[model samples]
Target chain A: MASVETTRSGGDTGLPDLVLRGMTLGYLGWMVVLPIIALGFQSLVAGPQAFLDAVLDPQAVHALKLTVVTALVMVVINVVMGTATAWVLVRYEFPGKKVMNALIDLPFAVPTVVTGLMLVLLYGPSSVLGTILGTYGFSVIYSQPGIVLALLFVSYPFVIRSVQPVLLELDRAEEEAAATMGASGWLTFWRVTLPTLAPAIFTGAALSFGRALGEFGSVILVAGNQPMKTKTTPLYVFGEIESGNKQGAMAVSLVLLALSLGVLISLNLYQRRWSLEDGK
Target chain B: MKTRVQGLAFFFLALGVGLVAGCGGSSGPDASGDVIKLGAYSVVREAFHDALIPAFQEHWKQKTGRVVRFEESYNASGAQARAIASGFDADVAILSHTGDMNQLVEAKRVSPDWAKNPTGGIVTHSVVVIGHREGNPKAIADWSDLAKPGVGVLYPDPKTSGGARWNINAIYGSAYLASKAAGGGTPDLAAVADLLKRVQANVVNMDASGRQSMSSFSERGIGDAVVTYENEILLRKREGKPIEYVVPEATLLIESPAAVVDSSVEKHKNREVATEFLAFLTSVEGQKILASYGFRPVDQTSPLLPEFPKPAKLFTMADLGGWDEVQTAVYGPKGLWTSIFSDQGK
Candidate 1:
């Protein structure tokens, strides 16, 4: 029995496991790490002036501003929708609950390009709904609203998945006790419920915002890639590269990387803080 | 009982390892130096599949006696430039224009001057006014006909697509020519500027696919006209869409350049074979093949194939400041075209 157990140890399979880990690390290094390092080094060679010029360029600045603004709106929408989704899934029992439960995972299964295409089909100028919307001059495909929709499509899953576990783990007895005390549902939700979910919601929104900010493929397809308006930072990075301005491209890339890092760090800190409070 | 379970576990572990090893076998091509990677923009990719690949492979095989293979990545010019700049390797990069090649130069990945590099003589393609609908309902005759009130336009985003830049330049060049034919005696590029702004007002939205722009125009009622490569119009017409071509009295040319990647060839030390592939592109047989694929050949007296349509007003890079200037000026933000037309999106 001891020999059998010992054979299962990582040490016993050291060569293959080490090779597997090395392969994973190498794959990640080529795909992610090496390019980031090269890009960072390239940006550094351009120095501060190029960075400032890229960041302060009116068009890059506008695109970056729009990316942040849309991401914030998406974060708000996702937090509300995702929290409600988690709460309902945790607390409610209804017909088709199992099917409805399966649907939350659908966004994960669906490619974002499909999501953008679906939005275009449903709300674009050609669709039945789109034509009606078009008559009112409410074009959705190539406007600020389209960016919002695309961001929402990509980032929606993050918040729901993030909050569901915390909501499920939450004690029902506390809510019942509040109901017994004659507290109103809204009051109970506000005083007893919100505080517990706030940290999770925050973490999810940060993830959503980070994902939303960096989205390229789907957003560009729908957003018309309008300079100074629909052009997100990734799209801006694309334009800079096309224009033969590698320094400009690298410089803007670093800004996006820095912003993403900031969100990830804050989310990490919030998770740690919330876990400690939960422990106490 | 424990020994039986352990034996079963070990069997499963070996099975898993075997599966991974089998998958790992064919996952990547030979990492040995024998294989050559060629990265290109889209049409060359199609041409390689259709025309160049077999010839190049045969030619390389006859010479080296070792099997030579090419790895290719193809995309729109801007997107591909990003991949190359970020380190996708290519022994050669055959692209639509010199703007993207200049990007590699600007990044110091290539020799400072790509124009001076060994490659030759006019590779031909054409663009024309891809009109509103069958029988030309809008009757868009000249370049200025796009300005007819209530006539919207659909085209690829210029910032993101090389073909769209050619499309933009076509209209702009014609407008400039009209300014000259009026005999004030010079092409006023600014007229191209004004024309673009007015046309910009009518653009419902810019899309990335030239075909998608046409499809959107037809399906979504997105626009009245799309300016795209004439080959695109022919390609689409074959699919049985109701479409017509408007050969504007004035037109700009599309020349697809083929070049060996200086650094990539040096690294691979396959300059002889790489140069042969380019030679194949400029060869009479290659030009003949290009013509078959609907490229209007630059060799005028070489006899016309009956199927291909002749361009009305054929022009080339020599007419527009060439690729270096186009990269610095038009595709560059400070360039007249970008400074003017790009503002509409904002």
Candidate 2:
């Protein structure tokens, strides 16, 4: 309580400080808290039995399972591939390296629906690769694989963007020292570089997974939107709304909101702990 | 600390007030209440936007001394209906199916006697027709041909799309009629369910709308044939796209309904203008405009365009016990369509 009083009084606080604090709180309340509160009340409006029925519906359960499984898979793929991409961009010099680095953010720039369309065009049944795979009864688009592919495209830049700056700021002296001690490239990367990169990689992977959990546009376009098959939670919520089931839609939406909020809180806590460790 | 908490509470209270103000305060009458909002389904979007609206404006201007301005929003029928029912403030709603209008009627957003008008609550009509690649390579002439091996069928999902529900009912109803004609007995639900199952097996993907499914067939080359609205096929043909379409014998007639949303019109106090707009939609001149855009006019006696081909056997929603019974029987829990695709059906 003393520290809080000192923070308010000890600084060169002015009207701008008060005004800015008010503005920030106003924006946060109006945009974030209000909508979430509205959704919360709407979900509970139908009472406990209806809420349970919506959450435990067979299609809802299957969609939740699919959403989680696909997001987890996306986290793993992005952590590895995105880290590799960042490492290559930072370390290697190639003819088109600059273009490739810029191209890494294209997924973020292009619309999700366009990404889904491109994936379906390239790997759907119309393509040569798709045809060969279809012969073996392995389909890409309109299946679980397509959902993962779309998630990978959208979440591609997360880990790369997170790890790139860390890699750039990292001192390479330790890796050079390890090299002089006769450590192999893989050994140096494993024992030295990866340890330092772990925190950024995990943070970015968590963010990517959180994003995948709420993905709807690209997943709906490519995953065929088959209930209890490739339908994700967001798509299920959409279906519920379109079918005039507002209670069911609100319930599923609250589920997604809770999951994303959990991710955000955990990430915030992780960052706070790391900052405390760095301060000490 | 207590002051800060009070500030936070005041902020939230202000936010709640702002939300209510933002939503509720916009719909009051301006200087003059000559503006009417029209919410419609996507299949009729181009027609309403391009052909019908301009003509209606001209007609209204000629009929009345003052000009009427319209604000329109279009999407899936069910989506539009939900928006209107949940307070989107649409004065008149032109939807793709009776199911959506029925939902609004049930919600009291629309008047119960909306159908007591001239055209029986429907304004536009079409049949579930098939669109195929140029030259008709699959030789698909009827619904049963889609069930043949190696034929990939494309249609939207019934769960989200009103048009898709009509398409599915067309398939089921056509099969039931065929079976009944052969035996002179009532439709066997088992046989009808089996036919639907066979067609479901060839489904490449159930897109969200008839327009989307048509694009997946025509542009993406995903499926061999698409079940879509007859007007969509005619519109594409008019566009000189290298596509051919056939209306199957014994197909379900798609009856799209229009209504003056009672609550919205009453709120806006534009009930007279909204009613006029709806009546104009089913008028002879309006029917002609709809025909130009490939929609079969709701007035059966109205002259159809020369380019529009009539289906040999057209069945109404009544043939299959209307949308409620059909939705329950085919798309409901333990519904045959759901069971045919997955084990999730009760």
Candidate 3:
């Protein structure tokens, strides 16, 4: 609390402190706030009715719905798989464990477009696996599943990274006490470990969901980009802008920007509350 | 501690100033020589970069006894037109269709009467054709064949690609002609919509640009046929890629136009060179190079004209009541083509 207060006030309202604070805030405002304000102004320039029309346009609505649904699907799978990955990394020792941990962050480093291309190479209609899946009538590429798959790849590291540190730092004494009290291993994990990991899992899920919402490069290649079908919101915005419908593009972009901002703001609030509880 | 904070602040301020300066510091045309910026659609990238620009530089140098460097940019036709209209500052603009050119005119970047030239501002000619695998296993002879069940098709999304609009227009136009013939001079809009819907249903993927669609067809092997320009398939063949294509019996004539962007040329003081470059593209020598690159020459009298076969029932934008009418009738909200997706729910 003392450290927090000192950092908040910067110990003194001296010239260097004011200069540092002003510069940081100015940089953020210039780089981030300005563009968001510009987008909002452009979309609202024609009035709220136009903005509503653009957002509610059947094609636009369909794109927004598709983006949200695919992201949600990705989040559900990521929560399960990512939690399992973190669990194994922390609770077990194995060969190549270090290499596996390093490789988990590779998805974040690789370009999203390359991620899209890699996925297409593996699951496109002509690939051996894709052809095999096609015979079963469960096509992957150029469909909703492909969209979710690309989202999963791009957001793969989010949940795992968030949960790993929490898992490592977790106090094992409570689980041991539960086991010594006759609780089964699964029961101990559910009653003791999961509650501690829930916040980290939620943070990871929220972060990945926000990331997936704006995933353009990877999803655009796999999604067939059929309007009212595979086209996502970012693709719709690009199409509108390229086709000289700037108003429509701006309106849809504003919607996405607002959605991502809402997610990040709520995550911040949740983390702040959780940290306060932890401090107690 | 205070000095460290001050140093960090100075560092950030300098970084900000440097970023701003870097973005604004692009050099203008050099005074010792002339330069012309050419903004064109993506399909013409190979032709312009490899053949036309070098040929034009030689022609300009021989005529004026001065070096004329060219700056080139190629994008989807509509995107290219939007770029030029929004201050991209290209002295010359070559696009896939008049509708895109008209966008520049409306923006006052080009003269309203820019098409008043020997070639009506059109520098190249092509036709909407179907590109299939070698030997054409599916036998996609016409637009109707593309609508058949189990026949996978590929075309770019028209909203982003001007070439895709032409491909879709060809299908719609052919269907319109058939409906007109059956209705004894009255075209059936419903029939055109039905055919477009069916073909759209079979489309395996719709990439953002025509080049991407061609790649999806040739490299990915995702579709049985690709609705694209004849010149695209010819260019692939020139590269020794085994590709087969068909010129549909009734197809829309693809007229690609080039015009000097008045605002850009005026700003760069490059009007003279830019004007001459457009003139050269229609000249017999220029036409010859374009023809070699698979573009149909605009000048019908050029010897290369015979190499391009005429379609049985060739039609123009005017035949479909011009670009403005077609834009509204096909692409506008509630237009036939636009509504097809909504009604079919695909």
Candidate 4:
């Protein structure tokens, strides 16, 4: 790693470095920045009053609140379950461990629509389990829980993948020292290991939260898309666009885009801080 | 590392060339025949693709001694209208309602006088009705039955579905007409709004489209009843699905419009073929094909009319003061239907 860094720094002034940098920035500007600017412009095209009305519409507000709440729920669950899965993968020797490791990424590969359909088939009213649950006055599909479930499925791999590498590279020396000092396994994890994993956990949580905010395909199927009830922001945006309320669609979309941008930027800053502390 | 980078560049270049070649292959019109692009609502896709297009092709060939190819595009009505208005370049537009067609007119893609024809430019007709599971477990007979407690109903969100607007309009119109009859010509807006709110409260799922609502009712078995077009239920039953529907005694008539997009027809030099296609849609042969697909023909005297039972108090948009008034009263900002959802959230 040191040698590679030395070579890179040695050639930092070369034509290839400049070309690569320019190409990356140019590609990113065209693909990502340009579209975001266009969306920003369109959202304000009808003037600030129209933009405010669209954003402040009761249905839009409810949809935005629902999306944020569901995404938060998904992020909380992902952080706990994902950290445990990563820990188990790093510390335990179990049958099918290799397969389980690979399976963690299956959610990423599967189309989000298929993910929604799978959830619906599993927990929809027609299924036996869903029927039993319904008989007990519990429904999953076409309700709030279904929205969270869909969000969870689509964002499942974020935390696990983010924390797994950090867990793997973690030295056991600190954990052993804590153990020698009469710390319990859970205590050692909390005091010695958890601090090291905190940044990674936050990274995963933020990424999944960002991803869950924009999730549509799976959420739409399971959400039932009742305005001010089950509809999330993305679905609301879709409804607005289809209904010819283009201003409302653009306004809500800008909110989501801003939120996702905020998450990524914060993640970048947090990681930079961590790296600076590591350099110390 | 440098060689790897060069290899990656070459790969991307090859992929770009391949993509360009693939796109170029299919986009050009055939040299030997004329092409007419048809942008239509999704519900008419089966009728057009399976029967109308082929029949028209044969007729045109026999009459003009030239082969004419069709480029078909079908989407939900509003989306299709928006697409054509925003330059989909479809030579013809067949949509679910005049409101969508009006959108094209406003965009100047279609002429305002497109409706100056024998059928008022409408190609097909249907009535809003209630679709239920076989055996009529819910005993749903009218719009008010959908508002009954403990009965789950399905309809698409009107914000996204032109069909949902029709469904909701049927419910609202039935109530409004009843109030008008009782009050000796004064329609009670409050009663209409009340009925809409009650039915919406019973709606278990508001799918994105009418087709999705039907699937949710039939395939997923989620709802006890579905408010949809009469043609949708008939089409399903004809496809061997065990579904039954009831035409409410008082329901709104669904008149779907079609027209030659003047801009696109002129651009494609397809005025003659496009004009003929619209003419054929109202002709006896075209009406028969549409009727076979469960759509009520615009020509009330057509032989296929016998298959469609007439509702006792059938009402067109004119009964509610036409599309412009209905749009503002039912679906506009602060509209009755729009406010119902917001009021529920409170």
Candidate 5:
């Protein structure tokens, strides 16, 4: 009876379990690993020298720079605004609070392409606001600012969703204790609250940054797709494919994949370290 | 008790498998017995959906007393072509230009003799035209006008859009002809490249396809003028959208091609019908349908649509060394477009 129980629960049910593990591994190998491997292989088709040239091309470099710059700006905006929003929803009670909280997730619910269209409708050249801005020689649509705007909308909810739960579970006693010691509100938030919330905030920022890195649909519409000027890496990859240069596309895509994976791994490690410190 | 738990787990697993099996039964190709799969460029969606498909369906039913289904997918012409080449399993492809169709031919999905077919390999035609606001506020008249310093032009990126490739070629072709006529010598490549550079400088938005770029012009009112297919302008005007367009004096006539994907049709055992469908598109009735939808009929025998004004200097892809040469010189790796924008600042 003990042996049967062990086999059923802890010991792996032998042959069937082995088969199931194999199936799961095979499925992932087929779906995820194979495509990435294929891309890597295809990138090497024109030899390593050609692959390097394709990736290091002047236009490719500009696109990468633009993608990174926009994504970083988006991260900054999302982290600040998203944290403030989550803080308000968790700490303060205001009219339409529930609706406001619900609205924060609208970016996640709507398609990315539609987000671009909405931005254009609100900020395009002919709209009242857009016209006003244009009259002042400050264009938003079809520029770097437009790319950042699209990225901000698509990635706004990531940080908020990540930090909300942690904020909810945080103890308020420490803050009250700080207040009793005659600590100012800002001082309490900076010293007592921020340190505790740092890990969650970091985790959320990393997620938003990672998502913004791969943002294509929304940015494609707003970026104006000017080569070397407003074009992003994904758009460049798309252009390469359209021009029948699949090898170039694959090489650039592999670079993006590696960057995203590196960030993800770093984020995990960082979160783990912070959580470990908190335990002590 | 442990055995009972294991037994329950097994029961749930089997139930899940059964449910999955039930859901998957209707998803195979069994139901596609009489379906004609079409993968086409996005710009032709309206014409295909409204007139062409229904007419084809009626024609098939009347001839064979059997109903047929059309499974269609539409996207930018380059994307659609790439999809078919990469095994999207499309039986027919109606693409925007010869470049995309030639991509399929290079992949052997289409026959090499595609150009010599009954349809003249050219299925329907339109010239690149300038679309402006209702009152022609910008007063954009010709290709040269688009390059003016303050003019904001909207066109799709040549990399992803078949239509944009044609538009780019038209601009370059026009410049070449103008230069040739002025000097009475070989067409100057530098002059053509310079014109393209100027036009690119004035471009405010480069969307993925012609339709999307037109939307930026008409809907967002982003650009002062737009370069797009003439038929699109006509189609929009017919829909009561306030748009006016002009046919440049010297413009490239876009020859949109339609062909049967030989391998896909052969694999699906629908080659005869696919060939018949291609033939149908060039038929008198099909040409009429195309004309009604604003496409200049490939069948020149058909009466011309009065709304489609004749350009003083019209040219085909043949006038500019066909798709392969044009693609190589203008849009190939390290081509003219790449060189022109290579030093552009961030």
Candidate 6:
């Protein structure tokens, strides 16, 4: 035990360093590295041609385009609404403020399927509003609009939660000092407040975008799942599985996996740069 | 503590591996030595879970000191097929459609001849039609009437629901009534196909399951008329809804076939008993039980009918050239159904 400790601590000659290195490598290999390797191997056997076929299918292509587009659009909408929501909650004093603040997170508590089913119940063609929407030729369910609505419901909390802390940390005295300098309300916010909030808002939006991309339970119920017109990538994968297509499910998962990883890595790099800048 | 952790880990690992190996032999807890496991659709499962399972257990115990059991997952055919394809363990699967069984055949879990047996055994079957809130206010008498202005129709997706296909076939038959050149008395397949195009337009919701669709339609007032099995209509009507059913002219017939799994058929060591179970399902007694359960019997022309009987040669799966042909003609890309309803009934 003493000898092993001595070698491990490099107290004596370091001849067994190779063994230590191999052991360290093995731990990571089994835990972190091997599962990724297995995923790649499974994808290879699940028919590379079929994967390509599924991704390239006209229906899937449209769904992918719609998913990415809706997710991005949702992230943009939520960032503004969510940050404002957080700003109001953290920076205000009013009656019923706590209730209003908690309501922002109502979306998070609702089961996604319930969210979707509720939306249809409220706005489907059969509902009163649905009939009005139908009368106006502006349907929400069974259309692209419903996809965005579901995405927004699930993605709203990411921004509100992320922005709230950063907003609370914001020195309000700076705004007061800027007001003393005769700076306008808009100018005080733009110059003093916006930069600090950007990082947090972006982080929230990144998470929201990813959540929207992978969401399944809610969107299918409301989207009407009309093949090419309203089908999302997740629905397409589900349909393929039902059609006895395994390779297609893998391919769809690969696309989702690749996009999520890319966004997360880019986000990490982004936050790293911002932190470095703040340090300097 | 470290040793204990290792011991727990080893035990769980062995357990997991054992469970995976036991996957194919999966039978319900009620299985006695002489009985076989049968996976069933909703009605059969409802019976097994609520009534038949206990009865079968008691019957076998009293007669031969054995028990019959079932492992059930009851819902839409498409979901069931996907579950089976993803390695849901079952000795025998009785789904709402042959399409699901075909999935098992492709997986090499069941054989091609799984449907052939003494019963030609349709465990349960039903007539389907438009169900409305009392008074039939829209006066919907036939399938064509479903397209009337402001007629909000609710039906399950044909891709998923076995009963939904009969609705599809009924719609096809009605379309031919207006245009025989397309497919009608002269058996014009093209005319029938063309007629299906128009009916596809008025559909509001393409629900993935039958039970939920019916429940929502009745319980939540989701639609004006519901497309579903007569059994479901009967079940729903019993739930105190103001509902009435209208069977369209010359509506399509729905048939459900069931047989013991290939391995069970051969390996049960008592083929007589196995065959007897399936045989009992088709006898006059069995047929009567099915009728009482809201199913249409095999004999179409019989008196005291609960619903329409199975149609003749004109009403056959062979006439449509099997499931694959149906998929190609109606469900595939460039499919007539898609081309017609592309804009959702525009």
lDDT of 5 at B139: 81
What DockQ do you compute for every candidate structure? Answer: 0.34, 0.33, 0.61, 0.73, 0.64, 0.26
Query: Which portions of model 4 show Cα errors greater than 4 Å?
Result: A1-7, B1-19, B22-25, B303-307
Share of real contacts kept by model 2?
0.58
> How high is the DockQ of candidate 3?
0.61
Across A1-280, the per-residue lDDT of candidate 6 in tens digits comes to 0012232444544657778778889999999778767766776675668668767766667778888998998988998899888988987899999888778789889999999989888887678998898888998887788889999998878988888888887888988999999999999989989998998898999989988889988998888765656778888777666555566666777788789888888888888888889883
Q: Rate the local accuracy (lDDT) of all candidates.
A: 0.74, 0.86, 0.91, 0.90, 0.85, 0.70
The fraction of reference A/B contacts recovered in model 1 reads 0.53
Q: Rank the candidates by lDDT, best first.
A: 3, 4, 2, 5, 1, 6
Question: What is the alpha-carbon lDDT of model 5 when measured against the actual structure?
Answer: 0.85
Error of 3 at B212 (Å): 0.7
Candidate 6 local lDDT, B1-346, one digit each (tens): 9999999999999999999879846643333466554556664544446544455556556767665554456655666655655666544566766666676778766667776664354566666667987788888887767777777787766655666666676676445444554433466656566556545555666666677677767766766788887767765444455468776655555667665555545654545455555654565655665665566676655565445533332344445566666666666655655455443421
Question: How far does residue B315 in candidate 3 sit from its true spot (Å)?
Answer: 0.9
lDDT per residue, candidate 1, B298-338, as tens digits? 55555643345556666666676576766555556577665
- Between candidates 1 and 2, the one scoring higher on lDDT is 2
Q: What is candidate 3's TM-score for chain A?
A: 0.96
lDDT of 4 at A199: 91
Clashes of 5: 0
Interface RMSD of 3: 1.7
iRMSD, per candidate, in listed order: 3.5, 3.1, 1.7, 1.3, 1.4, 4.1
Per-residue error (Å), model 4, residue A269:
2.4
- TM-score each candidate: 0.79, 0.85, 0.94, 0.95, 0.87, 0.80
Model 6 chain A lowest lDDT segment of ten: A1-10
Ranked candidates, highest DockQ first? 4, 5, 3, 1, 2, 6
Q: Per-candidate TM-score, first chain only? A: 0.87, 0.93, 0.96, 0.95, 0.92, 0.85
Q: Clash number for every model?
A: 1, 0, 0, 0, 0, 4
Worst 10 residues of 2 chain A by lDDT: A1-10
- Candidate 2 lDDT at B13 equals 100
| Predicted candidate 2 versus true structure: per-residue lDDT over A127-218, tens digit per residue | 88889999999999988999999999999999999899899888999999999999999999999999888878878988898989998889
